[model samples]
Target: MRVLIVGAGSAGLTCAWRLAREPSTEVVLIDAGVDPGPDVPSFLLRDMVLPPPFYWDYAEFDRGYFLPRGKLFGGTSAVNATAAVRGHPWCYDAWGSPSWRWERCLPSFRAIEADMQFGAEPYHGHAGPVPITRCELGGFDHALGDAYVRRGLARIADHNAPGHLGFGPFPTNRIGDDRASTLRTLLPELRGRPNVTLRPQTEAVRVVMAHGEARGVLVRTAQGDEQLLEADRVVLSGGTFGSPEMLFASGIGPADGLRTAGLPVHVDAPEVGANLVDHPYVQMGIEVSDPAKPAAPPGKGALLTFELDGPGHLQAHAFAYRTRAVDPSADPCSAAVTCALLTPESRGRLELGTGRARVRLNHLSSDVDARRMAEIVARVADVVADLASEGALRLPADPWWHADDLPAACRREVVTYHHPVGTCRMGSDTASVVDEALRVRGVERLMVADASVMPSLPRGQTNLGAMMIGHRAAEFLLEAPPP
Candidate 1:
């Protein structure tokens, strides 16, 4: 089997690692961004979110804000904070597909994680490509966590533990100080594989289809020459934004939108770019009570998760970190408590743009989401206030929470956690873009195995969930008798 995988991100790389192991299969992984070799910079390799890269042009529904999606070899995983959370079991059960339920998907989650701390546990895998370990927090982090405990947020034994909630360390994919990105882990294993080819700086423009099947992909090669790579199967692992954009460009999206965009419609799949969702983020700035105590670090020290509406309905992820708006040098004492709306009712959409997917993350569009986000922000502020009373922390004078109109403040400041999903929503129905097996509707020998195929957004960071999807896709392909 000759398989062509688009976008060498988390999912695509995982698929490559899985499929290339079979001698009968030949896999080609392509990415538009330049692939820095095994040894890349710490900022690109570790959890350091670099001063927004220029290649990240995907913006929010509000034109002013830019949504960052890493355009490099490892995609956002190469640039994101190394948070390796799979979220609660209910998050997966909410997908409404038995194949994707927590019970069925748990093995994939376990198969992909080589947890350093919880190796003996059945929920965690000890020998896998991607390394998972606990986040090592500092003194200020412990103080804030202690304050949260005092404020009634129970300290759980493990954050990744199923059904467990409250404040605990974020299980990150790291080895000592360095990161364990696919480039450093998964790719290295497939590097010398004779059947696998990793093509960096190669852009897949569109999937070439004929007779209701994907025949191959048209690409702009590294040297800027258009090339056609024929394949028996094509996997659209280009991620949420890139996958739908490619689909729309290839005339597989909503018919009216395709007509408006001057593209011929091949498949009138209305949901191709619809049902967009992401975890809307809210941040609260914090100051150290004593000037002597140093501020929190870049990555989250400890994380707290709780309910908004009810358990497994609307949840929020809270953590301590440094915000971009705060000057680290001038206000060395200032840090932030960031929270993201995990279960939002609001929906967003993606439209084809001149060169990319026009992402309309109508974040906080739902009044419920807007109000609930405000409530979470206010609740987090109240916890911080308790910390202040205990002489552990202080609040910024006239903080955004103190605004007379809290909802308006939420509308203004609600942002994305960079975890976008459901662009190519998966389900067991005809309306869904992909089936439970991730095969694109009305299309044969073509599949999507990235964050784009998620029926709904996961409750926590999506990096781990995305990799699990890729792992599951490879398993699906492997189990099925080859066509």
Candidate 2:
């Protein structure tokens, strides 16, 4: 059987690698962009230094913003922060899908990760394609860990551990001296496989469908010429924004939305571009009084999460980090810390623009959501201030300590964590585009296997969740015996 995977991101690359391992299957991967240039630096690999000559464009939403999602061979993974985190157990249960529960999905997460630094743990898998490493702790990580413990927060050895919670530097999908992106981990393994062909600089315009089934794809080459590729099955892994836009252009979204663009409707799936949700992060940066010396270089730090309680709120997810905490003296110039409210109550949507292929996100549209985010920021600020007051840490005597000043902490900042999800939600309801197994409810031979399919936001970061979805989608496709 021939399989075609679109978008060479983590999900697309993972699916290709998994399927290519099967002796009887022929796999082909297509990407709409080229590889990162030799002169370009990766955010994860370049010692957390900002990449030189930023490659992509950003789309401004309401108040918050979206980064320029990569369109390269490795997708955003090639340039993301490389933080590895799995969603909470409730993330799956709330989706109303049996195949997505924590128990069923944990195996896949284990199968893809080869954790080297943290050693063998029951929840961690040792023989996966990707390498998971824990950043060696510095004074900040130790101080934060100690503070969390003193405050009666649970002490977790591993955040990736199922049902585990507490404070620590969550494991990263970065290998020694390199970021463990799909390009390096998954795609490299399948390089010599004859059955798998990677075609970069090939933009998929739309899914070619007939009689309610996906026949193949229409693509635009680097030369700006149009071409068609026929395949038995079409997997849309173009991510939250690209995937839905392609589907809508192919006449598969809401009839009204499609009609506004003067396109004929094929599959009247109104929910294709609706229900978009993202983890809006409110962050604050505090300069340390006595900045620690960098052991390696600047931009090395660990990520820490905390659970907060509010009136009528059972639990909320918030995270923090002391920049330069990984290698204390990495940057001798200055030391800073950043704290973000990860699971803000704010939800957003992705809408098609009047022009062709133009997409915009209505981020932070609800005032209630904004207030929730503000509360999280206020809480994080308080925590930092408390730690400073106790002499556990020292905060610079700066006037910009308020949560409202978060937007100015970093220049041109945005929230993606590479976790844009829920644009193509899955459920039993009529409004959902896909079913439990990631299969398009009303279409044949077409499925979405990326973060976009997440019905709701996950608790932590989303790299692991996206890859797990790819792995599970492949399993379901193989077991169902695609026709």
Best by TM-score: 1
For residues 23-78, write the lDDT of model 2, one tens digit per residue.
77888789887755443454435444334333344454544343657667667777
Model 2: per-residue Cα lDDT at residue 215: 86
Query: Deviation in angstroms for 85 in model 2?
Result: 1.4
Give candidate 1's error at residue 482 in angstroms. 4.4
lDDT of 1 by residue, 1-483 (tens): 888999888999998898988998899999998787866766666445456541467776455576777788888787777777788888899899888989888888887778898878877788888888876676567776777777778887577888777887878887776767776788878888999988888899888999999999999987889999999889998899989988887889899989989998999999998899988887787777665655445443678888876655678888886543234355766777887888988999888777667789888999888888888988888877777888888777788877787878998888888889999999999999999999999888889999999988888889989999998988888787347
True-vs-predicted CA distance for residue 182, candidate 1, Å: 1.3
Candidate 1 segments exceeding 4 Å error: 47-54, 290-295, 298-300, 309-312, 324-330
lDDT of all predictions = 0.82, 0.69
